[model samples]
Target chain A: MRTFSRNNLSFIILMLLPALLLVTIFVYYPSIATLISSFTNENLRIPSSGKFVWFLNYTQLLMKPEFWQVTGRSLLIVACTLPLEILIGFLIALLLNENFPGRGIVRALVILPWILPPVVNGFLWNWLLNGEFGALNGLMYQFGLIDKYVFWLQHPSAQIFWTVIVQTWTRFAFPMIILLAGLQSIPQELHEAAAIDGANRIQQLFKVTIPLLTPSLAVAIMVEFISAFQIFDIVWTLTAGGNVGQVINPYTKTLMVFNYQMVFRDMKIGMGSALSYLIMMMSMIVGVFILRNLYNRGVDK
Target chain B: MKTIMKKSVRYLLLYTGAFVALIWALAPIYWIIVSSISTRTELLSKPYKHWIPTHPTLQNFIDVFTTGQKYRAGGTLPTSELLISGLRNSMVISVSVAVLVTIVALLAGYVFARMKFQLKDPVFFYIMLLMPLPIWVSLVSLYFMMTRLGLTDSNLGLILILGTMALPLAVLLMATFIRDLPYEIEEAAFIDGASRWQTLWLVIFPLVLPGASSAFLVSFLNTWNAYMIPMIFSNTEKSQTITVVLSLFIGQYEVAWEQMAAATVFVMIPPILLALFFQRYLVRGLSMGAVKG
Candidate 1:
């Protein structure tokens, strides 16, 4: 490494200026402001100046039934979707790791849902779930699976279930691709070793493949859960109500949606900021835990 | 003969699994394309529902582009000027944000990869911390800040907002890419007395162009697909993006499934094309952050 000379210092300062300035002006400043404002009583609709009311917003959130419901719904979606996504992702990764005809095209096609804009993905699924003239209904009716069209988005529980499906559809490719990379990196000699020891395919998979895949799998799960927790656009386009829309059904909304509702519908900026902080707090706890785990693993190595 | 039969059966099962996977991935897309091409009559008819449109038309695409027409359910096509302006706004913001983010992130990433500087680890740590904070957390204060600065409903505001969101990942990815480059090349440039700035632009930049371009592409797609920033930052046609408009279509009095599908295809084409072309860089860059961090 180059020593810290005057010229080197100046160059570093000059090069880092644009990024640092932007991050500060836009990200750091706003985040700090949100943190500070979260403590006060601020309302967007009424013009009264906010006065300091420490912990009130957080306490109110704790007291609110809707808040608990939204938090629970967020966890439920993650719990339901993450495992299926990981399992399917692992299966697809295993499949793709093998040599097959047109495998390249299949790999590209699998990523299509992930690449498409969330709003577009949401709308595509919304159309598929439409009660009046949905493709799912058409196919189901053709196959004699259902006698009538299903209103998939009208009810709260129904909305929650379909939203999880749409999210899983669009997002599973992330884990699949990452895990595929992980699988490919495992040395072929290990499989040879297992075969020499009379270990069959299933045994090799359980003993060799999975243990080797733990690191990437952990990374994939952490990344997936984090992104899923903050999901907004897909849910927004899929089931959020119209402007001046009524209170969101308790079953269907996530923390981000509740955050939006408080800010826009309830016009409670302080509570909204508080909710944002809570979301950040949850993300930070998980993020820090993952980082610590990675750090410990690195140290062990 | 028995071995041959077993092999054939295995191939059949493999192909069957592949076929199921393909259908799972492509069915929704095919349905959208089918909807985009079908007319109101075919879209509603039960017999036409299960099969491809016998009479396909590009009227929806043409309408979306030329007349700003959006399909409405059980109603005549409505000319949506918002669609046109939103496309324009989205393109402008996405392109500008991409360029700006690439330049900024490359600079910072280059320094971090190569330089020995004070507070380096701390600065990088700060940026990494910013990564996990969701956009909604920042939206409240960003709205306040942008409105206070009178940058609301403007292209520049949207660019700043989205650019900030894209910076951390781009920088991290770029830094990793640059770090992997051959160090001797930069050393040779330095020995020739190219100076630091000249070395970065002339020597290092071209070597990392592929990495930088991928960074630009990812940043562009992220900004293009962003909904919350544009939804809150820009209220009018002058600044609203494709995503905001597409979402509003859902809440419209008459939802035009065909036109919505058409507009969706239009909005998705650029990113899809970019993703296809830059698949190599994207796969590497995306997984790098996950595995490395």
Candidate 2:
């Protein structure tokens, strides 16, 4: 029996080996390498063995005005989109939670935008919002809403606003699903008790529903905050990373886009590595809170 | 009369909200389909002619499938070959990553779910921490690593990278599903004198098929939709995915709206079908780690 138990331990180790090895090489190793590379002078454009620069990249990055601008823009995007996503998500989830004919079908169809590739969503919106021959302009003209077509992606501010809109469109379904699950798990008896106490629907929602839905809402916000901070795919396809030329559109360049230009286009590998760590640290701050929440919930369970 | 009015108001609000939801979800999809089928002349016309296409055609989709087609503005439509190859590469990568990640995650998930081990909680927690680490943090090093190993521009490279990207979630999902199962069955298998391997394969495997399928579908969709990794890693047509190829269509000197729409439609079909058919599993898999305990 001792030998058999020993064999079972080996079997368990063998089962976990492949996943462990993959995660170590792909996930953990690259992370450590990025940290190490950030301290070195690694430039792909310059043919030189990268030597330890030790704080040069970080100091340079911190001093750049563009760095602060891009970081601010990324945060602004999170601020603008998170509330809208949560609000619309909550409203839709509430609407969907009520009994109706074809509720399931509506629920399924609503997730269409979420499931479509983010790149495809970007292109789809680009076509619709095109200035010269856009469907949006056509619809507005026909409805007498506008006298002429407008170049939607022309101005930098408009570009940023549209990015927020498209981001909301692509992402709202996720929160809706999370919140819907939260709503379903809330015992119907709570609402019933509230109603018996002469509470109105709005009162019950504020008194009971909102309070119960906090955990799911927190999960949605944290996850969306991370995604919105790392906004790349939509921005890349929508505005061409602000047209990818001599002057990158300052308004539209978020952190990931800035990192891409730094690493890929500029080939400033060292600076890009530093930027990557900065982005990771910002995200990790949020991630730590999320893990704490998960840990607390796990303990309760 | 007041009761009737209140009830009517409730129904009115519900249906109105549902109508708006449908339009919100389906309008962009509908517009893309409309754009894809419209004639190039009609699509290019400045002022709108019709909300619905007056004369729809499938030429754009045909152009996507066929090679050597000429653009209306007189340049060779170079995307057909690229798009087709992209589609094939995407399929190969997504399918392979799905199978590979699913099998690996299932093994790890089972061990975490059923086995006793030292430092198990810490190990599992460490893996879960990888979940929130944005992919950009390691992309630079990954790029260098892939290039050093000569894995760039290769489907296998993407399969490996994308499989790792999908791993943490798949493992969590599989573990969640496995944990929900009754322990009595495994105990009964043990009492039958079956080896651990035999019990895992014959007893646990069949029971966890649903979880496996969920993990597979999620991984498949994620790989199919992955852009940044494939974009950086696979620059050549050899391994560029449909998403990457479609991205190349935009920001040109003269954008091809009709054909781009067609390609967008083509890329959307699989995920739409998956969402429609396996919604229960998709929702369960997606919301696994975030919402559930």
Candidate 3:
């Protein structure tokens, strides 16, 4: 043990240094810095009196209608997009899981959209959603479904609806890939045994597949929710902050957008810091809820 | 008899589904390719443009590249010189961030994975805990830090943020890969009078490079496609990202449909190609990470 320690101790420390530096500076420091700034009115571009305001920023933010509106909009989009992605992803996963020719090629094709830079996906959909000279509009007019172009982003409902569609496309590949793994992991013998006991395919799916795949589904959803909350790039690119920095879907703003406007647009750095903390607070709330529920589950078990 | 036919036909249905899925996914991309060929005059002539153009031309690509006209937020377009320099800036930021993160993550991740320490487990958990927070939560505060360091619009400023964000997951993944490697090789080197640094350099890093390479790929992808940090830091041509520049084509009065589509496809390659090449290990790593959790 002493020999091992003497031989590798510094090398071990050297390996730890990069991660430690990265975490301390970028992750831990910025988060704590945000926590500190949440209380002050400094918005300090240069060094000034870092005088404390003691939750005044938080109070002012809570009073703003725009803040509440953006929060509501984020929740509404999450509610709409999350379940549909899970359902569609599950179906796609099952379809891909079946033994067939060119299965590897098919899986590769399915993963394509997910790997697209959020910018590419957003731009891809922007053309498809265009009112004039867009492929979708041209097709719709050809089929006599409409006499003229449908202004997609102008209307609140179409923008939000289409945002859901775009978000779904960008994100669905993740859950499908994860779900495919989960489906492949299930024992084939269980299905074979169930078939002999007079169980049908649908019954076997519900009885065996769904329950067993819950953990993977949970991971996929976790990624989706966290990413969905950060759904800035697609929305920003597709809608260009959508008419005074509001979401095209549901006619609201998000914490990220709100903060962007506050700091970069309005140059109100104090309020921007406040908005950042609010977002952090909401994430903590979700994290704590998940943890408490997990604990309760453990106790119950 | 019905059961036998149904069973036989199921395989046929799977192939059909596979074909349809590929077509649906490829359709939009194909439309972009076809539209990018048309003259602006031909594109504007009729309400219903041909799926394949009549006077197929590269005029729009020229206009987008040379004319400097981009869609403004309120719909009327603006003449801006943002395209060429923006592309240069993005390339610089993405490639630099990728190289830097790979080296740092390689060193740190090797340590976390192989070396024993008192705080190692908790420190690793801390990295995971920080992963799920939407990074925008820290954007405002970090902006201040960048400003304090005089890095606000610099490529270095953006690279620092990008490299930092990529570290946590890269290290976590590195740790897992390192832990899986056998210890006997390193132990043998120790007995042969090799110094600790010598053992790490000569023995460990080479054996585990593929996993580090995977982490590098993931890190590079994150930075290459990133828009928000660049969006906030610099909108000027010198430091703007490809994603931010593409959005300039989206305006209130009009959408530069063809140009945006063309630009989007151009910027999509680095990350998508990375995934395509490294897919075998990436998919396996993703699965193992999920199961481990």
Candidate 4:
């Protein structure tokens, strides 16, 4: 190994400074600032009152029924979509992993939703759910499934349903790609060996394939969970603060929407920062747990 | 005969699954395209045939590009100048961020991968922790900071904000690619008495050019599509992005669906083209991040 001289050490430090400075300024500094501000009365309007209040924001936020309800909706959305994404993503991955004509086209199409600008995805769904000109309602009417336009976004449950549908549409491709790569990485001989031992396809999938794909599954789960938790764009454009903001419908409000409403709409910068820290902690805890298992599985090895 | 029957059944299931996946992915996109081409009357008609519009026309496209007239079911409405500036702003910000990220990530990634230094492991861990850390946590603080610095509503500010947003992942991605470079090449360069900087520039950087380009494309797509930051900071037409402008097209009284779809088509073109062009790199990049994690 070449010995590292003082000059070389300085050179490495110099090269690393830009990234370090940027991250420190933007990522670390802001993150620490959020933690610090969460404890204070750092209102955007009342900068003079930005005093350290010592857990007051946290306590107050926890006590807000409105906040809890939004949190519940966020969880509900994630719970509904996580399993569906995993199962759907796995099935698609299995399909794409197979050898067939037009497989490339199919793969590209599958990832298209993931690749498109998410704001556009939200808008596309908005148009599709429009009561007057929505393709969905029109299709239903043409098929004699409904007698009239449903005004899907007006109803709370329907809003949640449509939001989750659009979320699934856009996000499932990520897990699919990850899981498909995982499936491809698995050695073919393991399946052959299972086959030689009189295992059926389903049995082989359960015994060999799933166990081997666990790491990928963990990754998919982590990505899906974090994304679903932070889902804003789809809900924002689809319902705009949800049915609650529109018609006092309560079910469609999520933490992300709730935060936006609080910070920008409500102008409660201190409380919003507190909520942001809360969200960050929740995601970090779950992320740490999943990543620990992923590393423990020795998957990266 | 039994095995043959089972094989055929399996193939049938596979094809059916593939078909469903394709339709599920493409249906919304197809609907928007159809909506963009069809007139408002056609779209609102009872039991509208959405698969293929009865009167397919390019008028919506023409309106979006030339006249800024939003074709609505009610009438032709004037499109805001925000749409034009939004596209221009998005292009400038995305390109600048991509270029900035590419250069910064390359240099930092090289140092992290090749250098031996104190506190390297901890710094690296902190950087990696940022990969999944949500940006909303910092948004409130960042907004206040930007406002104080007089950086709000400016292209430079947005670029800085967006570039930093993308930096963590970019660094990790570049480091992975650089770390994978053959050790012997660098060793040979060192043995030939090339300095460390000389070796990186002459030997390592050239080898990792593909990785640099991947970083560039990824950063471009991300910053280009970013919604919340631009929505928060760039409230004016001068700096609003395509995503923000498109969201505004959905007005309170009536939504101009056809024109929104037309604008949607325009907004998607850059990322789609980039993705198609860099298809292989994208796949490899995604898989590398996944597997390495």
TM-score: which candidate is best? 2
Please say which candidate is ahead in TM-score: 1 or 2.
Answer: 2
Task: At residue A34, give the lDDT of candidate 3.
Answer: 74
Per-candidate TM-score, chain A: 0.92, 0.93, 0.87, 0.89
lDDT measured at residue A26 in model 4 versus the true structure, 0 to 100? 75
Off by over 4 Å in 4: A1-7, A45-48, A241-250, A289-301, B1-11, B69-80
State the lDDT of candidate 4 residue by residue for A191-226, as single tens digits. Answer: 999999999999999999999999789878887898
Residue-level lDDT tens digits of model 1 in B1-293: 99999888877877787788888877998898888898878887762274688889999788766775443431454446777878899999999999999999898888777777667777776666666667767788888888989999999999988998888778887787787789888787777777766878899889899888778888888888888778878776779898887776777633567777888888888877876788777666555565542
Total backbone collisions for each predicted model? 2, 0, 3, 0
lDDT of 4 by residue, B1-293 (tens): 99999889978888898888888988888888887898877766766555788789988887777776553322443465667888899999999999999899888887777677777766666666666787778787888888899889999999998998888668877887777777788888887788877987899888998988878888898888898889889766678898877776665324556776788888888877776678667665554457553
Q: Please say which candidate is ahead in TM-score: 2 or 4.
A: 2
The DockQ of predicted model 4 stands at 0.50
The per-candidate TM-score of the B chain, in the order shown, comes to 0.91, 0.93, 0.84, 0.89
> Candidate 1, which CAPRI tier?
medium
Candidate numbers sorted by lDDT from highest down? 2, 1, 4, 3
- Candidate 3 docking DockQ: 0.43
Docking class of 2: medium
Question: Which scores greater on DockQ, model 2 or model 4?
Answer: 2
How are the candidates ranked when ordered by TM-score, highest leading?
2, 1, 4, 3
**What TM-score number comes out for model 4?**
0.92
